[model samples]
Target: MFDIQEIRSQFSILDREVNGKPLVYLDNAATSQKPNSVLDVCHAYYTELNANVHRGIHTLSQLATEEMELSRRKIQKFINAEHDFEVIFTKGTTEGLNLISYILTQKLQKDDEIIISYLEHHSNIVPWQLLCERTGAKLRVIPIDENGILQLDYFDQFLSEKTKVVSVNQVSNALGIVNPIEEIIAKTRKNTDAYVVIDGAQSAPHFNIDVQKMDCDFFVFSGHKMYAPMGTGILYGKREILEALPPFHGGGEMIATCSFDGTTYAGLPFKYEAGTPNVGGNIALGAAVDFMNRVGHENIQNHENALLEYAQRHLLEIEGLKVYGEKAKRTGVVSFNLEGVGISSDVGMILDKMGIAVRTGHHCTQPIMEFFNIAGTVRASFAVYNTFEEIDLLVEGVKKAQRMLS
Candidate 1:
């Protein structure tokens, strides 16, 4: 059995009341509530080891460097990367995706193709589009099925010699759909020499990620969504591919030596991490990895799956209510809207009044909304501390709203 109360105590902010009522923070997909251990690790970094990393001869500076390098090793084991240098600390998923686009476009010639999917967040889509515009390379999109799953039939037809890269979300952020990435990569690789990039932002937190088994060329995920501090992300690329790729930016740590004639770039992690990186945030991510290990992801996955099933059934039972991505055994997330609500934000606001928080709007997947013929869906995402009683409360709240409006 999952200990809801035990997990609740781990998050300090979860204890606070919202709108004079006990807070039911269903807005976890936006960002998760961090545990005290994660917070304390971040705090300890500033208090004990505050210094710029990699360039200091002082005691504190050496300690800071130790912490950052150790953090990299932790991330290596966290995602089970083949090599430690393959893990690059980024600002977040947005930066990681942008780095891929920047690196690929620098190498690809005109007419080269990088395929993405409609299920991707705007962060994944816009950067590649920008890169395509710069390089005169075309951006191809793999269409999705009616249920928000990626259409593999269309995917096979799209992959060819022209395809140089394939970037996809492992889990749809807006739809709560787990993509068939392993199969997609297998077939896509069979057809041509395209690099496979998996956005594990949603999947990393909920499930155990074994990139070796997946064989994705690149993997990206944000730290904040994984119970770590914001301002940190992980980019795990195959070592040879990463070494062959050009650096995304030029600056302080990323240079071997500066000269008016020419400049040589730094090696590996330093090459990708241009300037002063988030030392404290990177250390906190290590703590998050430790936290997840302590509380087994199997337990986390089972708990959340139960919540998703219960919430999906309850949401559909209500009049004129529809739950999108009604995939059984999905990660504990539901995207839906009430009938005749007209605007999801209105419903979201009302739910907030009752101390039930939810996310509203296109959820950074405007293309997905366009494909579904919906402006947006009200999203209620779950975490470990979330309960069946909370789902019951949400059902009651929605029923109250429906009746009041009727």
Candidate 2:
């Protein structure tokens, strides 16, 4: 079990008072607040050892390079990848998906297919659609049940010899539906020559991730979503597949030797990282991972699940409130709409006055909104640092919004 009060003290922003009200931060899905350890590590990196890596032979460069390499190992351990060479750093989740899409399209031929799911974020869907247009391949979407879970039973119908890739989220960001990813991977691999790409942006933060157990061809996640700084992410490709795929970008750091007619690309991880990378952010990511390990990832998940359970039971008591995505054992996420409220945006404004910070909109799954027959939902996502008192305040704020909107 986690020391809940002790963990809350680690986040500096939680101490902040908003308009004489303790801030109620329920926007964990959009972005999580940084803890002090993550911040300290970033400051220490710049103040003590700030040097470009891999190209330097001096002491500062050596220190920087060592830290950079350690960061890679930290990420490898975080996802339980087989090797550090398999992990390639990127700007964020969007960049990771783009890199995979680009590399796959380069390898694919005309009339090939890539499988996607309807529950995916636009980040996962749009890149594959673009790849199809670029390579003359077709985009095949795996349908979802009315409950927003994948209709994984029908996956085989869409796959064939021409299906070269199957990219889907391990957990749906909007619906908080955790898919049976290992089963999906086994089924897809048994039937076709498709490479499995997992969008793990939501899954990485909520649960313990093990790429080896997943047996996935590719796994991608953002550091910011997992308590690291923004603009730092990773893409892990199996060694055999990564070695075979061509480089996604061309630039200074990605080349070993270049000539007028021929150029030799850099090594695996460096090959993916072009030009000046986010050294500070990457160092901070390692710190974030260290902090999470100290707190225990399993403990964090358990605490957050309890918070979600508490919120759900209390949220339903509000008149004219309908909770969406009531799947079995959800993550720390709840999407709901106030009934008889023509304008949820108006409700958010009223809640803001009371210091609640729930998100209102399509939540980046506009297609899902069309399926649910609604414009959007007000989402209140939770994090480990949140307390029962804050949840009570969240309910009070929502009830206040309901009365005002009604």
Candidate 3:
């Protein structure tokens, strides 16, 4: 059985007050609050095992190296990768995508195309843009419907022999719609030889991820979005593909040997991880994986689904309040705007004064905002610890904003 209160107790930040009212945190899509277990593990790493990995022969270095690799293995099993070395440690999803884009510069030629969707975060979009600018490749975008779901039928028009890569997010951060990635991958395989990439940043905390089953050539997600610390993330690539690609950064740990004449690179993961990694952050990420395993994905899904449904139902009842992606399948996010509020940030400020935290603005997807012909939407995203009562508070807060602004 999943105990709501027991789960809430694990996140101590939920107990704090904001502006003299009990804090209701709903900005989870940006970053999640870390659990006590993740916090404790991070502290223990700094206190007990503070040494550089793979360089020193001392006891602390050995222990630190073991813990860091152990974290890599934990992520490997969590995502069901074929090999532990395929799970490369990255700073976050942005860096992972940038690394891939940098390496592909050698492969992509003039007029080669890279496809992405209307729902991607800027991290997924800009790197490809840079790649196109550098390599003389063309960047194509798959359009979306009015309801914020991808229009998969239009995807065929974009797929061709010139296509070299197809990268998309599994979930939209601005609208919170879960995309049809499996179907997209299937269609891509049928049409072209392009490598498929899935940005799992928004979906990793809410659902189970099996990269083997998904069959994407690359999958990337951030630990900070899933109860782990910032500056830690994962980039899982197929071993053969990773081996074929050149190293993104050339530095100390990523080298086999160095001389004035020439230099050779190291093995699979170390090739991508050049400098000293965030050993404690990665260990905390492992602890976060363990925490999620203990609580179970089924429970997380059910609880978050409940929160989403309750929030949608309540928020939509307000006069002139519009919720984006209301008709589409989504996870734990609700983006809406009040009728009279000129800017979404006004609503967010009003909510914050009432101790209701939400995110407002373009949400790093300015194209999405431009598509809707609006500045931005107020986004309230839920996590495992959020409750029905919090949704009630959000409803009242939105109503208050509406009355005050309109």
Candidate 4:
């Protein structure tokens, strides 16, 4: 049986108090709270197996290597990648997208087009902008509607022979609206031979990911957003596509054999992984995956959906409160602003005094903020452990803020 209290118990931070009140954590979209399993695994790895991976012939090194590779396999199965070699460890989603953009500089020429949507985080936008600046390529964007949903009709118009890449997020980090990635992939495949990249940083935590079913050339997500430690992430690509691209960084492990004359790169995953990796964090990521598997995605989705609906309904009932993306299908995020509240930071500060932790500002999504003709929105994003009672506190806190500020 899916027990909310049992699930909440696994996260020790949920029990803590802030400002003399219990911490009502709703800033999950920025980063999720770590469970006991994940924290324990990280601690165990450092205490028991503290050695550099893929280097020495010692037992500690061997064990460390095994644990890291085992984590890779877990991620491969998690995303349903065709091969384990396709999963490359990255610093996070930003680094993963930047890696793709940097490597594709070789393929992208002058006048070549890269397509991204307005819903993208700065990580998805700035890299492509830099790529275009370097290669003299053109950048095209798919528009969004008033409801903050992607204007799918305009996506077809952007597809053409010159289009070399179509990179988009599976879910909007700021608005929490799920994009039609499968449809986007289908359209890209039918119209052009462009490479499709799905940034799963927001979606990976809430839904089951199947790279094979999505049929995208590349997919990337941050482990920290999905209950793992910081500095751990995954970048999965088609074997053929990954093999064709050159190494992103030149360092010790990524080389086949170093020589004064010339050098050769290593195989699939190692080719991308340079220098020392976060062995403990990767192992902890595996534990995080195991934890999610134990909880089951269906239960997580159902619980979070309830939280989203209930929060939205109650938050909207407040006078002078406006919810962004209210009509769109979203995960567990609610973005809103009060009528008289000129700045989002003011509201966030007031909520902080009430022990409600919510994110404020553009959320690294300036394009989305621009579209709404506002400076920013107060975003309250949920997770598996968040409760309806906490959400009630959030609503009441916002009401208090409104009364105090407005």
Candidate 5:
């Protein structure tokens, strides 16, 4: 039922060549390439429906507003949120995390604790650190093992009645480990009344998310990581929780009425979404969501899981190559290093020369690098369009890098 070639044909960039070879885009963990459907929808939005949302009374404004709100509904359905208004448009996962931190920390008191994990992206970590500095809250970290899995047992020891918030990534961007978020959320609830926030920037691309089932207070993800354009993402919060939190940014759109005496903020999502939004990008993001639903996430998961397995099996064939985070569950990412490779960037450059794209360096998780006791590892992340043959090319490229750099 799953047609790999049909799926590949939808992405126009896959036909292009880089450095005289077909581009094997394995850098999906950074940002995914867009499909023609998303591109076409974006073009149509700009060409036909280019107008500001909410404030416009003209026909174009009404149409644009409809599309923008439609995208919110689409995201709500995609994540199975209880209410469409719970989905707030954000620039991306980073902005969502920062917004959540800023609003939630207002409730914190001195000596209140915020719990995070060692597997978190810097986006998930730094905002909490800044929040702690602002509110005098203590930042607690749940450690991970050498295999890159979280030491979940330690979560009980850190979480207490004083814990105000708990932020974690559902998937590690650097290591591609699928964290036990459901279990984590359940445990956090048992220990304290902390608000649980999940960073789904990586996991959203590979798995189906049901916020109602997961029962997390806040969930955030980037559209670019899941075949949508950059500068578009979503933040889903419980309706009451969002209403309770103060406005993140203040401006024209987020306010209900402004007077010389006082100002009242808009209801639900609009209170948090200040200023003009990216209407075109958000519509395209809706199209991207539709594309995923059309293709079916189950098919995407099966195909990507197969690719991950194939890549891991073949990559291990090379001598002195060490793969990080061989956890029980993972997404379509492989971060590895050759025994003799002095720097990850060198290996990445060599792979690029061969038209194999991968991510190098600390990947914005310096804490993860510190745990690994290395600078970084070369990461090759797959998407739905990627094939096993591309994985072969990547393996060969890694072997070539090992030989040439050694």
Candidate 6:
């Protein structure tokens, strides 16, 4: 059985206070707090194995390289990727998406189409937009209904033989809706030869991921969002697709041979990973993955599911409060707006004063905001360490904010 208190104890920051009150951190969608195990791994890397990886003949360098590769393999197993070489180290999801967009654009031509959804974070949207801008490919969108669910009916309307790439988030960062990615991928496979990409930044932390089951051409996620150090991320590509696409960057590590006149790039994962990578972050991310394994994804899901349900029921009880994205299946995220409160920032500020940390603003998905005819929302997201007491505080905080701010 999963012990909530014991699991909470693993994270040291949860004990601290803010604003003379116990901190109720509900801003997990923005970034997660790291466990002490992950932090210790990062600290040990810097203190004990502070050496450059993959080049030096020294023992420290070799150890660093081994640890880094071990992390990659751990990620490979975590995601059920077919081969270790399929996992490429990246700065974060944004960089991974940018790399994929840049590389895929090379294979595109005029009049090609790239499809994305309205639920996408700007990181997923902008890279494809840039790709379309450069390649003369028409950018298509998969629309969403008022319930924050994807309108699959429109997918066939936008898809065609010209469709070259389809990229979407597995779970929305702002609304927390789990997209029908398997259905999307199946339909895309039936219609076109487009390469499918999944932004797993929000999904990887909440549940188990299987790249083989997803069968996506590329899958990207951020380490910081999964309780690891910042600047560590992964880009998982099918072996065939990765080998075929041109490298995203050129540097010392990604090269097999280089001359003043010409350079030949390395193969597989190294081909995409350029420059000195985030050795400590990647190693710590491995520790984070192990931590998740120890706690078990199913257990985490069960706890968070109950928490979200409890929060939603409590939030709906407050008069004039409208919770967005309730009609669809969601993760541990709830975005809402007070009836009279026009500016979400004001509510966020009041919550902060009350020691409740939540995210406010467009959350980088302005299209969704525009869909609801609102500028932004107050998002209270949950994680495994959170409890019912925190939800009570959040509710009281929201009601207080309503009376004070409104």
Candidate 4 lDDT over 1-406, as tens digits, reads: 8999999999999899999899999999999999999999999999999999999999999999999999999999999999999999999999999999999999899999999999999999999999999999999999999999999888888899999999999999999998989999999999999989999999999999999999999999999998999999999999999999999999989999989999999998999999999999999999999999999989999999999999999999998999998889899799999998999999999999999999999999998899889999999999999999999999999999999998
Residue-by-residue lDDT tens digits, candidate 5, 345-377 = 999998888888999999999999999899999
Error of 5 at 155 (Å): 0.8
- Estimate TM-scores for all models: 0.97, 0.97, 0.99, 0.99, 0.99, 0.99
Q: Rate the local accuracy (lDDT) of all candidates.
A: 0.88, 0.86, 0.94, 0.94, 0.93, 0.93
Question: Which tens-of-lDDT digit does each residue in 1-406 have in candidate 2?
Answer: 5787898899999887776777888888878889999999888889988988888899988998889889999989999999899999899889999999998777787889889998888999899889988989988888876678778767878878988999999877776777888888988889997899999998888789999989999999899988899999999999999888889989888898999999999888778888888888898898888888888888888888888889889999887788877754468788888888876687778777777888888878888888888898888888878888888988888888887777
Query: Candidate 1, TM-score vs. the true structure?
Result: 0.97
Model 6 stretches with alpha carbons more than 4 Å out:
none
Pairs in clash, predicted candidate 2: none
- The runs of at least 3 residues in candidate 4 whose Cα sits more than 4 Å from the true structure, single-residue gaps closed, are none
Give the per-residue lDDT of model 6 (tens digit) for 1-406: 8999999999999888889878899999899999999999999999999899989999999999999999999999999999999999999999999999999878899999999999999999999889988999988899988899999999989889999999999999999999999999999999999999999999999989999998899999999988999999999999999998899898879999999999998988888888888999999999999999999999988998899999999999999999999889999799999999999999999888888999999999999999999999999988888999999999999899899866
Give the better candidate number (2 or 3) by lDDT.
Answer: 3
- TM-score preference between candidates 1 and 5, better one: 5
Evaluate candidate 2 by giving its C-alpha RMSD to the native, one decimal: 1.3
Candidate 2's TM-score: 0.97
Measured with C-alpha atoms, the lDDT of residue 101 in candidate 1 is 86
Best by lDDT: 4
Q: What local lDDT does model 3 show for residue 358?
A: 98
